[model samples]
Target: MNWDDMRVFLATARAESLTAARGTLRLDPATIARRITRLEEAAGAALFLKSPQGYRLTEAGLRLLAHAEEAETALSRGIGALSGSAEQLGGTIRIGAPDGCATYLLPQVCARIAEAHPDLDLQILALPRIVNLSRREADLAITVSRPKTDRLHGERLSDYKLSLAASRAFLAAHGVPKSVSDLKDMRMIGYIPDMIFDAELDYLSALGVTRVPLASTSVSVQLQMARAGGGLAVVHDFALPTAPELTRVLPGDVALTRTFWLTTHAGPKDARLDRITGLLRDGIRDEIARLEAMPVARNP
Candidate 1:
């Protein structure tokens, strides 16, 4: 019957892992487990089934989840209304996004947000895998593909270009590819085939590459490898600017396009969410424009 217990229950259910719930609540695993136990005892029913994978909601837990979420929404709206003043608005907003976008772009976005709202905190989880918004893993997520669930809302944030690139040193050591066919002889850096989290990141296939000689699960790693003259990589145009020494390979002959989709759970409307979303949209547009204007090096 304790609201605090219910809050813990909701967080645990959404995260499905004591470790993840602990991160969200900033509580120890032992304490979270104890709260769930207390909550179950009060309700006179088991709320969760524990397994190695994580905690899964029991039927009782599932039934109670809806009521708890409704209460949470009401409370959030009340808090927002009470803190209507811009200066008073403050809370942590967790954003989950692909590693490349989060690493290269979101730092600037978060900086601008912090400037506008000094008290608000932004947490960026630059994960390679998909973030589960339905589970509240992230307050907002920037996904390569849109979610098909009705419980979440999303919009196309921006369409960015991808192209083949290599370090100036790599090109100097291994000859530049004059055409797409020449790419077959070059050492290619890319995502590990089985480890690619999203299908849209399968950049090599689109470029007529069926096998990758050098690959990694992390985009950041791939970029580093390319910069170290390991091989050529298909990298985002926006991200390429970070390494000015890297030159585009087969610039005119090869180009791939992908979209970034922004998603959030359908919950209580918060003014802070609106402001952050606007910032994200504007930031991405500016970056895309900058990327479009970047000149690519053509092979002689």
Candidate 2:
């Protein structure tokens, strides 16, 4: 019945741990426990079933979740309406993105956003796995592939290119691949076949590479290996600046392109969401142009 109690209940339910809820609410563990007890007493039902794994919602808790979310949304909207301007908007925005993009691109974009809105908290989850927007895994997701579900909204963020590349040291020792056929002789770095999270990431196949001697689920790891003279890797052009010692291999001959899709849950409109989306969209567009203009040296 109490909004404060519902807020505590929602935080605990979502986090599933008293410690996590404590951090989220900035309340002591004892206070959180007392709040949960009060909420359960007020509702006249046990809201959660505790186990070693953490809190599991009871049937009653599951029933209350939908209404709780509605109330939460209403509160967010009310707050946004009172904020009066996009610049005044403040809250956490969790963005899920591919590891490569997260490492090479998002930091600058996030910094720019922070510079403009100091109150906004931006959380970027740069994992190789997919983010489930429907489950509230992330407030926004920058994905290599688009979702097929109707419950989400998505837009093409940008089409970026990838190419085979290796460190100057690696080429000096092992030789550079001159053509697609030459790639067969070189040690290749790429995503682990079985661990490929998205089809768009299975880039080795596009270059006629059926096998990679060095593989990892993390694009950043592949880049590091390639930079260490381990092997040639199929890497995003946007990521090239990070390793200046590396050079593009068979640039024009072996190019792979993929689009990044911006996805979010299909829910009520919010000014904050629109502002952040615009920031990302514009940032990516500018970065894509910069990537395209980067000079690639051909094997002589």
Candidate 3:
């Protein structure tokens, strides 16, 4: 009997209806029925009992089911093993990362790969939602938190420092506060409602400052608000220096921080991914050093 027929038998047997099997397989119902008929004729026994409810599997069908599942599993594993044998680092590597990570980190990584391995293909999925590596949704990932699953290989890449900042125009109009207590009277741009635990909130809360309830979910919007001289926001040091008008508030001692991580699945070795991770680490390290070295206005 054909393995194709056997696979159809398993599908039809499990689904209990040719219509359902067709839907699951995305094939026509007649095609599924034809395959079932072929399988039953080869077996010389009825595989299912038709009823008003659905097709119920016969004892013969159940017996074949065990073998069919085993065969399918073995076939899948064999295919995976075969693919893993390739030593070339040229296939598409699906990578997922947060928004800023994609914007700040990937360009440099892509440049490095282009210089070294031009044939390598990279597909990046940039979203705030973390995709599952265990489910094969992504081949590699970079996240703020290390995944707890044993199926992943997670690593802490580095920790980043954050500070509260605003445009000089905003500070001038809003009247710069000299003390942490003075923060209550000042207008402040806050994290979006859902992002109350973000760096901005943490920094304000740590200083015993009362945050203004106005919040924007988008990081880009928050930056824009600060840039428009609307209010103060907690921006990462790397981001702050890029804004010509933005200046650090309480520069000497800020409590906001976040950690960066590099993570991947435990797959066969890939030189492209290894080289990409190395570039990302170097870029982040360089940025951190640059931010730390820049002097900010001291609260005198």
Best by TM-score: 1
Q: Who is ahead in lDDT, 1 or 2?
A: 1
Report how far off residue 71 is in candidate 2 (Å).
1.6
Give the alpha carbon lDDT tens digit for every residue of 1-300 in model 2. 888888888888888888877866899978998988888998999999987788879999999987887787777667666553655647888999989888888888888888888888999998879987654668889999888887688898999988788988889888877678877788999999998988888877877788899999999999999889998998888888777878888877888889999997667746677777888889878877787687766444
Residue pairs in steric clash, candidate 3?
none
Q: Each candidate: what lDDT?
A: 0.84, 0.83, 0.68
Clashing pairs in 1: none
The 10-residue segment with the lowest total lDDT in model 3: 193-202
> How do the residues 1-300 of candidate 1 rate in per-residue lDDT, one tens digit apiece?
978888799889988989989987899999999999888999999999999899999999999998898787777667766554465447888999998888878888789778877888889998879998767777789999988887788788999888889988888888988889888788999999988888999888777887898998888888999988899999888888787768888877888899999888675566667666778889877877876677766444
Backbone clash total for model 2 is: 0
Score candidate 2 by lDDT: 0.83
Question: What TM-score quantifies how close candidate 2 is to the native fold?
Answer: 0.82
Worst 10 residues of 1 by lDDT: 80-89
lDDT of 3 by residue, 194-288 (tens): 55433423456666666565566545567778888888777766566557678888665554678877787544334445655566677666666
Q: Give candidates' CA RMSD values in order.
A: 2.3, 3.2, 8.2
Instruction: Estimate the TM-score of every prediction.
Output: 0.90, 0.82, 0.63
Measured on C-alpha atoms, candidate 3 has an lDDT of 0.68
Q: Mark the regions of model 1 whose C-alpha exceeds 4 Å error after superposition.
A: 17-20, 26-30, 51-53, 87-89
